[model samples]
Target: MTEHLYQPILDHFKNARILCVGDIMLDRFVYGSVDRVSPEAPVPVFHIKRDLLALGGAGNVVRNLASLGANVFFSSVIGQDESGRMLESLIGAEKTVRSRFLVDEHRHTTTKTRFIAQGQQMMRADQEQTHALTSVQESDLFSALKNEVESVDVVILSDYGKGVLTPNLIQDIIKHASELKKPVIIDPKGRHYEIYNGCTLLTPNHKELAQATGYPTTSDEEVSKAASILLERVSVQHLLVTRGAQGMALFSRDEGPVFIPSKALDVFDVSGAGDTVISVFAAALACNANLEVAAHLSNIAAGIVVAKVGTAVVKVSEIMDAIHRDMGEDTKETHLLTWDQARDKVMLWHQKGLKVGFTNGCFDVLHPGHLKLLNEAKSQCDRLVVAVNTDRSVSALKGPARPIHSEQDRSVMLSAFDCVDIVVAFDQDTPFELIQHLRPDVLVKGSDYTVDTVVGAKEVMGWGGSVYLVDLKQGYSTTSIVAKISSGSRN
Candidate 1:
């Protein structure tokens, strides 16, 4: 999508009023490392590093909509417990959310706890009450729906199948909302698709679609077949199936399916990615964006979120940046590279008998010396990979006030140079992990570091790689530039 087309669609988000009704829960992520096997058992011993908390289930949908700059009206049921209070605080923290939560005294709040190590999920535990809502609770929810449905531009049913969206209430809400001429989108859960009779759209993953229709969805052809079967059998208007890495498929009664290839390059975690997809899709539809445009935006948003560490939110700026890069307009010959992406490129370079080069630094401010080093590094290899430190790592090394530019800005600056073939960012103090992963043929560094002092020199040498030290230009440094600026001297 072009910037001009996408920018206008995204701008519509600010003025959108969306009503989200369904389940809500707390998502907890526990991050740590496992090093040695336990003495008592054969399990790896996990050392806890930190814990992160976010909203999940339908609450996640609410968060995503608010993150995209929507004024959202959210209605859900939570247990009267500590987790419920935490969930309430999280909801209240959102600047643009108006929420109505009916406390269910008989059930505890739903919570999913995940353990992560080495950028991967180790295990997960879930706690919840999934029985259908009581009679009183269902009636109250329908009342809340009727009270808020007419005023919003769009209505979303985010069902986690936790009893809040009962069968009768689903029919009631859909029928009532349709009468008021408001569009409804559903992130459906469970296998019963018949109750969602008149929704504007239904979003289900491939597995969910197959489960609902009892048809195969392992391939594109199968997914289309399954989507067709479901749409034909049910009264739902349209279907959008998220096919994980294969991208997404959109199907309607009158038109053929439209398939969008996955935009994700490096997938770290897929938690809450569905919420992102539905949130963007509904917000776009509310603002008068067509189905295809909403699908593209949602796909891009999902790609951005999966590349992150945990259940994360996608901001407008990141989506804009991804769109810019997706258009092949980054630069003349530059594309940002992840560790896995750079390794794949190195493999191709090796296949063509080309030597791959690597260099590492914060590169906070580029000067004559930096250019000299890069030019010399490029002179000896066919492809050069510049691994820059992330903003956190830079703050740990330099002071917090240093690094005049952000990681993205720094990467763009380095990518603008002709000599830099690939630019990757690393959060560690040293680029040893990335270098060990890429295993470039030529490791380049400035003369300030000796053969013994370089981070990955030994590993490179072990793998038949050579380390070359470039001579630094005299009287030019990032420190000197910062000092000069601090002293009010430009010369």
Candidate 2:
């Protein structure tokens, strides 16, 4: 998707007022390092280094909404215990969220403590009660909802199968939210989908969707069939099934199912990824985004959270950056361009009044010196294009054994850096032809080369362009690194 399509939708999130109701809990993480096994048992003993506390379940949804710059009205139940007080304090600390937590004196607050070592979860311990709320508690919750539901742009029911989301309470919430014409988004749980009747959208993972529909959700066809069954039973208008690695599938009444592939590059932890998906989806809907746009934004948000370490919240800036990166990926061809494509791109930049800087190198083995040169080059202009020598050109310049990494790999690595805006591969030994065609505003080279020694200096200077020579870092060279490794191997 283009930035024009989603940037405004993201901007509208700041004005959205979300009503989040359902289970809330404290998520405590103990981070440590495991050195060796304990003598008392076979388990490894961890040396605790630090610990952190974060909102989990529905609270995580509120955290996510708030992080994305939304105004959230969070309603949930908690015990009159220490854990409950902590949870309350945590919610109160968030400036964008207003919380109304009912205190249940008869129960203990839900808390999940996870032990983490070396960036991996070792064990988890939970303390809580699962009994359904009493009639009086339900009445109080409904009363709170009535007060908050009228002003909210959307309602999100984050049910973790805890007592806060009883069948009766779910029905009441959906009915009341519907009366106010607010779209209700449910992060659903359990097999009983009827309780969530009339919800605008239901977000269930692969396992939950399969179990709820009594069918195997192994393929797109199968998932659509299962979702169709749930749509018949429940009054939900749309079903979004989150298939872990495969991404999400959206089934609606008016249109056929639309699948959005996962954008996650690295899956570290997926603890509260669902909360992120629902939070972004609801917020986008609240901002008047179409169903497909909302689903796409949610997919991006989910990708961000899963790459994090734990039950995490994504900020608006992170989402914006991800969108821009995705946009860049969509136009990957521009980054790795031919001479004609590079000329076209340079002309486009020139039309926009952007200064284009040109640099050339084999970039066989990227080191700190190369990064410093590129960074300095970028500082001299608005856009920096690095001309990478092809494998054959590098072999001619630096011998056959040089360029341990291929030209494609080098080009990709340079393109990944934010400082280098574009990468173009040149077959010639030097970038003389490439530079002449682009006619960049500035020509950059290392300090080792004087202006007269630079290959394209005369051509660039003839067009009122300047030449900049960046200082290189000492004691860092690709040639030296390769030689050092080779010597070590011989030794």
Candidate 3:
């Protein structure tokens, strides 16, 4: 399989504009060292060192979108207080975003203060009022939203339930978005799931899905049933249930449910992961990606964010690197790129001296064998692009139970490696179309098969390009690992 395929998608992120409307909060982190207990109370005394604050809630969604090169317009509520002033300063400094905040004296700007010691969060303090917005405040917020709703390609309802997303406000936004026929994506709160009627898409985590349906079962069938209920109940055109390690499942009106596995490998803190999801989703929609493709791109973005601690955002370079590494394409010839990011990168590389090399695989579980193959391919090219098979593709080729690691996990792990350059992931049985477009100088595959049998070998060779079969290290297969685990469990 060709690798390093996610470049095009990452390139697409540049210059996109997305409108975010909902509750915004500030995440304040107090970092310090704790060596002794407090004399006044039963608490560890923290010697404060540094303090940092980042956008949280809906603000985070906009921030993530901006990081990926999208021009973001944020519409939310804040108070005329210190924290609110800080929020404005923080967001104003973001050159990619324009803010139209409604100042409400009745409610303070929501802020969550987290105290961290030795890289561990000790406690969190939340300051906010979650009551419904007053009529006057709602009117002001509506007025601000009215000015931008018609101009943006997509609208995101990021409801943190912080008194900003009233039922009335949500209804009006939904109605307006419908008139413009723009996609309205929702990162729903459990309590207000029913109020997001006619949304283009609803992204709910596993816990929220369970809470919304009041179904406690963790079985796939049960979760699917619950997701269906919520989708129909809210009149949403599509529903995405985000399962932490399990990935995500997409349900559309005609396509039904398509499960996209989580890409996270080692999950540290999933704090603002949902915010990352909607931001990427809205950006993808603005770029004219299909619902399934948008969800897949969001799944890749989520994997990138969870690998970091605290509320984080993943950049387009990171996303591209992940896709390339996941696909096992040579990154040496290519710069880091995702499918959304590839068009521009490809054009630039054409002007430069670099030649793109492409390859792909499931890399279900990376072992020394896969590493040897990828390194060898990288050695033969200027840059390597890897295209990974999605969980769906793995099931079609390997088996339903194959790919022990989810797509997101596999992508993150591969992108972190130095040998890889860019990564892209595909759900098709083969990345033939992507390979054809890339028109790499070399098409690489494992030594197990002759070049004639390779999926994209003919396409590359026909273009006067060469097909190289890189040697795979012996005795390292996903099947072998599974068997070893099963044997140990039985013993």
Candidate 4:
């Protein structure tokens, strides 16, 4: 593919309009620090610290797509209740959201409150009504949906079995989307798999797939069979069966099921992971990504969401960063090339008195901390050259399953950054040779590392260059992101 081919795809995502229909829920997180045992009981007592409320379910899917720069329009049935008002307020405030909603007085809006203490989920309370919508409500929904379907690139049915997605409603949406030539993606729920027939794609977890198909997923073969059956039965173009740790399986009519491994390193809370997958897939498809590419990208997007807390959305930046990190971690070295080979172009760049900043790491999992460090490295110099350890090198330093994104992908992504002037793949135990050849004016590392301990600190200092420590962005690190996501808190 040409360098700019994917750029247009990403740009398309920035311009695509997506309509999200079905259930909308409010996700409320009650966060506290557990410091001591309770006086009344032996159990730990949590001291309340803060609380956060975010869009959940189908609403979260739109949030994720919106965060990734899509033109999002949300439509759903919400009760004429306080939580419904809250949902309206939140969705209305977003510039991209064009909502088509109905407020039913007979129902209460869905809201899930997760209480967390000491970075762990303590309990959860759910409030809402889940019943099939009346014919009148369904018709009203279809009327609004038909009007919006004509103008969008794709339609996402985010069903939490929360009443809005009746059989009639699903049928109408599928027919409308088909007529408009818009892809319809269903993030389905309950036992209503047949209701999602004629969808462009249906995304369900392994359990859901097994339940819907009456097949046990003991191995990849079984998973493939189930996915194929669902795809054929539902008359959908694609079937994505998400297997938690084993990753996802994609089954299409033209192509057999392809198993994609989970990209997530440390899974925290898997809340809304399916939403992340469907949103990414729909957005990628709307932007003209091939089904396989969309599936892979959405898999990576799920990896990002699972690595965070709460019902979180994955940004396009996060997806690109994941792709970059995967590339860096998968790089393989042919052999140790001589300085003549490795330093040919690099030597010229160094000789120009450019304040060449060098920062080297496995970057196995790129996070906000890494971004902050790279940005700081660039700020201290005219050009930033990021030296990433090769796959073998990372394995040696950080052990197995180290670098997530392969080295080539990482290099390509990092090179795309404005702050990153150049990217050099290194295979040695250290980037000593690259550093010695580049002789950077500033050697940058995270503040957690002292100047003396930085790998290339001494070399830079010996050549009259400065070894600087850039403090990590507070509360933003890969480890923290992982922990928070696992803990089911987004704060």
Write model 4 residue lDDT over 293-375, tens digit each, in one string: 88888888888888665566676756765676776654333323333333433433432324568887876667777888898
Highest TM-score: which candidate?
Answer: 1
Runs in model 2 with CA error above 4 Å?
36-43, 329-491
**Runs with alpha carbons beyond 4 Å of true place in candidate 3:** 1-9, 333-491
Give the alpha carbon lDDT tens digit for every residue of 1-491 in model 3: 12223345556677576788888898997755679999899989977644668888888888888888888788888887999999999899888899998887777788899887654668999998777888887888888878688888888889887778888898888898899887888888865577888788888888898888887527678778888777667788888888888888888877768888888877766879998888888887887777778788889889988876667788877777677767765565432355645533443343243556777888887889888888888887777788889888998898878778887778788888787777778887778887765667678899898987998888776655688897778878877888889888542
Candidate achieving higher TM-score, 3 or 4: 3
Query: What TM-score does candidate 2 get on C-alpha atoms?
Result: 0.67
For 1-491, candidate 1 gives per-residue lDDT tens digits of: 69999999898798989999988989986655678999999998887644557888898898889889999999999999988999999999999999989988888999998786665668989889878898888898788768788899989999988888988988889989999999899988888898898888999999999999899898989999999999987898799899999999999899989999999999866878999999999889988999999999999999988876445678776788889889876643334676756765665455344778999888999988999999999998999999999899988998989778888888999999999998999999899999888878789999999999999999887766799999989999888899999999987
Q: Where does the lowest 10-residue lDDT sum fall in candidate 1?
A: 331-340
Which model, 1 or 3, shows the larger TM-score?
A: 1
* Position 190, candidate 1: lDDT: 81
Compose the digit string of candidate 2's lDDT tens values, residues 337-412: 7675576566545534477899998888889999999999999999888999898988899898978998778878
How close to the true structure is residue 453 of candidate 3, measured as C-alpha lDDT?
Answer: 91
lDDT (C-alpha, whole model) for all candidates: 0.87, 0.87, 0.79, 0.78
What's model 1's overall lDDT? 0.87
- List of clashing residue pairs for candidate 1: none
For model 4, the stretches where C-alpha displacement exceeds 4 angstroms are 1-5, 33-47, 329-491
